[model samples]
Target: MDLTRFFADVDAQPWADLHHAYGSAADIPGHLRALAGESEEAASEAISELYGSILHQGSVYGATAHAVPYLARLAAAGHRTEDLLVLLGGIAEGGADEGDSDEAACRTAVAGQLPLILARIDAEDPGLRRAAAWAAAMTGAAGQVLPALRMRGKTETDPRVRAELLGAMAHLDPPGTAAEATGAIGAHEPGEVRIVALLACVDGGLPWGAAHHAAMLSLLPANDLVQDRLDLERNEPLQYVVEELLRRDTDADRAAAYTLLDAALRSAVPEARAEAVWAAETACLLSRSAPERLAGAVEALAADPADVSSAYSLLAKLGGRAAAAVPVLARLAGGEGDPADRALEALVAVAPDRAAPLLARDLERRPRALAAACGSLGGGTSGTPFPYDAVLLDAIRARLRGGGPGGNETIRLALLLGAWGSRASAALPELRSALPGAPRAVPKALVAICPPEHRETTAEFLTAAARTGPADGRLPAAAAVRELTGDTGPLLAAVADRLTPGGPAVQEAARLAAELGPEAVGLVPALRSALSGSVGERTSPQLDADAEIAAALWRITGDPEEAVPVLAGVLAEAEPTWMRWTLGRAARAAALIGEAARPLVPALEGLLDGRVQVPPVVLALHAIAPEHLDGPRAAALLLEAAERDDDAATALEALVALGPPALTPDHRRRLTDLAERDLRVRASGLEPGIAPADERLREQAREAARGLT
Candidate 1:
């Protein structure tokens, strides 16, 4: 707990020689000092910066292990350690550094020297005890961690801490957890303790029926359970056990789960019904049989307006097959609030073809629902391309005609037509009529949506727009024109003109050439000239321009060795943080360059050892050396990257290409589950947060999963 003592015993300055996320650990001491500093604001900032730097995106750097002991001391002294406890658990669970045994080393450090903190589990501060429980479990010293958690489990009075202790016990020793959870069930502990026991019983592979059902029923709500009991005879424990049953890997368990969930949906007690709603929603994610297992509950579940949202949410999770629920969802879609919005969203997903006509009805009746319905029909979220009939198209056409002169609405309509692509070319005349004083977005949408026959005209219009519109619109317009016509005539010349000494469009021109890839072969010399002049500059635009030109040349010339030096030179340049993404892109371009890239492997490996993006780097390594793909470093990097949302599909594609050595038994199982599980809510993959997905990403995940084994 003594900050000065902790800093003195450790050669803290040596940490600066090690690596953290944004390169060397030179800046670490300032942040560490700020953690215990007098100012509240500084300490808070220190906490955030530490999370981003030391444990960036859940990755542990060389500095992470070195700094763990100090963080442990800070947690012991009560310097806001909640997020820190989670981070420590994550590090212990998975080794963040692929090249080093940091997980084992950090586990050893905590197990050998952090006994005093384990004793803090008995501290008067419940928060400290909670932190201790998690830290102990993650320490990987099962011999020490289990005994302490078992002891704490008996005397831990705070139900929340008790739950944490129970969870820790379950993770540390699943077999031993059976005996402990059995005792807790019989002892009639608090709701949280019972819930934890119930979860452990299921996790430990213990029998999960009537014997443990009492614990779930014992949960006492902050409000009256008596009024709820009078309304319906229900078991709270059963409702929770059913949710866990979704994760169970057996059909019989799932059947029992569905039957119970369906019964709970009809229960008169709102609390019982609400919990059932939560369980049913979770059940849809259990496996590919989720929709079949949950099909029986949809009607009754949707009958209650309050419960309709949960039903339709599960249906949405069930994907396009749950077409039976569309009628009810269509009805609920007319209402207001989150439920209504979700109902419409789910309706669109489950039956986009069926929902299209109904959405047209909603479009005319509810202007509030119009935007969401438009999105569902053929807008941003229209996943799997369902055609809208003349009815809906006519309605939208009329609505477009009614818009004031030209607002953002006109752009939205153009985007909707773009979503429909050539199928909605009938509406192009309407869009063309509005283009007189419309924004540049209309032209972009027109380029994206119009048929190939109109490409010449679209190209000519966008080219004219580029000449006269705002400077900001020039690059996009030039890019669009290139896409439309593929005619290098003026584009190559225009881009080349910008490469002159002090031309304002030089960088923009360089970016356009890069976007055109190999087609802009004519602009390679200009890009090369731009690269030659821009090297070694510390400025950001120079860094970006350099990377862009390098990428452009490798793409145009089809040679990796020729591009490696320039790309590597950009990486070797001073002030790398600003150009890190550009550097990664350059490396990827070099990877595509083939055998000439062999010399760059040593440098690419250095990028992997640090906190730089590893997908492109690992991808480069995969393309270069098939032999190194099986190492602990390569396997760890690929597996981690293969599961991330942003990089998973692309990373998995590259990982699969590295061949079966990268596909371990565990990786195979994980991939199989992801493949077999229908993650699509309709045709699109379930996007994180509120963002909707395009159809291509949905197929990407599926294809990666299918290719795994």
Candidate 2:
């Protein structure tokens, strides 16, 4: 039984050997034990061979399984246990990484051998016990090893051994529980022990460890290690525990507690607050109501205005249950309060109708509050118009006339114009006067308000602005043009002209022309000409303009002949794969424009033939003419493609489109035979290489045959 020779033979054999070798565990360990008793050098060589083979190749066999049992027997035969443990540890660690069932079985065997080894540790010298603990830790079964270490910690005579046990406990709870466990070790143990205990308590939610929370907090001031632990906990969802400590603990402890709590709330998600709310509700139910918990949160909001946003978000989730906090909200929203502006904004968001009248009156007194109030009224729960619209409009107009330093007046004017809708026709003179200097956002609001007859006037203003305003103004001006013209040809042409030197403005104008419906038909030639001229520009400043114009042309003419070629060219030339796919789709979209695109059939067929795998091409051909295979040449080409390995699927698809009338009886029979052959091969559990693709091709041929029938 030369182990090296045996392993070499197994390695030479193929994977099929596994099926014939050791069928059960009983046959494995016995064989290895016999081998181990032969000779020390031979046994070690055998074990080493087995370990290397299993660890590297990950193959399982009766001989490989015997490797561990032989090592254990050698150790019992007065061989060095230290050497055996090192060999076993390496095998166990390697097996864990393999993650195969056989590797897992090997790990189980190693774990079974641990108790026997630990027994050796107890009876042997103190140094051996230390070595045994290290071996046991390597097994990674923390639950089993932790109890043993804890027992050893009680009377292990050597301080160094006890220290190693504490370190083992810390490693066991990697997620911060190590601190709590370490704290619990001796007094009682070392500071490291206490810290591990605190970590364990935080991690495991151990109520018994609550006593250490105060100590851990105190250590935070002087120790960076403790401060790190606090910071780690601050990021955890359970930081609420620290916040609760601040609230329920001594008043003297409140300041430091508040600092930790504030940091946690700032970093936490909405669910964190929900957890806090639930905790607060639970505490209030358990004891008498503690206003301090809610008060602490409210006070934090008052100290920092941004904190009020979460308070409102939390209250919204609490629904009417948070009605108790309404007075706090009201006081915060009141003038002279610290976070009053944000408070009022949040209150309207949470309960807009109830807060609307109060907000309206506040708008008159405080013009800065007017913008926030208007935004609130627009999006708030009321749905009805603002209560004091007349007063608000007067304030807005005054702000506009006064020409305030900031853009606040412009914002106020936009809100007022949006509020007016068609009813603001009386303000036409004022609106007209304000158009030139108004913020870009104002024109869109004016478009929403302007009357039908005045739409022309609005378009004139927008077109003028599009010509004169900054680059940013062009988009809103284009939108205004769309709103005014409502698919008129002149407006469509104007948008196209403005879009020629194409930027965002051109892109927006193209979109506007597309929205104009049939009236945009006039821009097709312009869009096509631009697309043609810019085809080779390498960087068509107007490529997006061309795409948008194509879309507008499709919308206006419903003619595929004019749009498909342009779209195909773009698809072929586009750099980004996604944009190429988009243009390919647009080219195929000609099929969707009704029978008018019948002329695109040759182009689509060419695209499909060119290996341009665009879905729209198939859809276009099907839509325009399903019975398109009218000639002998086309039918032969399809048949020839169907015969080729790579083009088989495409040919089958073409046949399916041509329908049954296009296929002869011989062709039909051939395709059905191919399909049946594939089905039989698959049924027998053999690999079906190109057979599935061939089957799809056959299906298409059958469809073509059926159409001929």
Best by the lDDT measure: 1
Candidate 1 local lDDT, 513-580, one digit each (tens) = 76667788877767776665555554555655666666677777776555677767766772434555
RMSD of each: 8.2, 21.1
lDDT for each residue of candidate 2 in 323-382, tens digit (9 for 90 to 100): 545666666677553356556555653454445545545553444344444543232222
Best by TM-score: 1
> Against the unseen true structure, what C-alpha lDDT does each candidate score?
0.62, 0.51
TM-score of each: 0.66, 0.43
Worst-scoring 10-residue span by lDDT in model 2: 680-689
lDDT of 1 at 442: 63
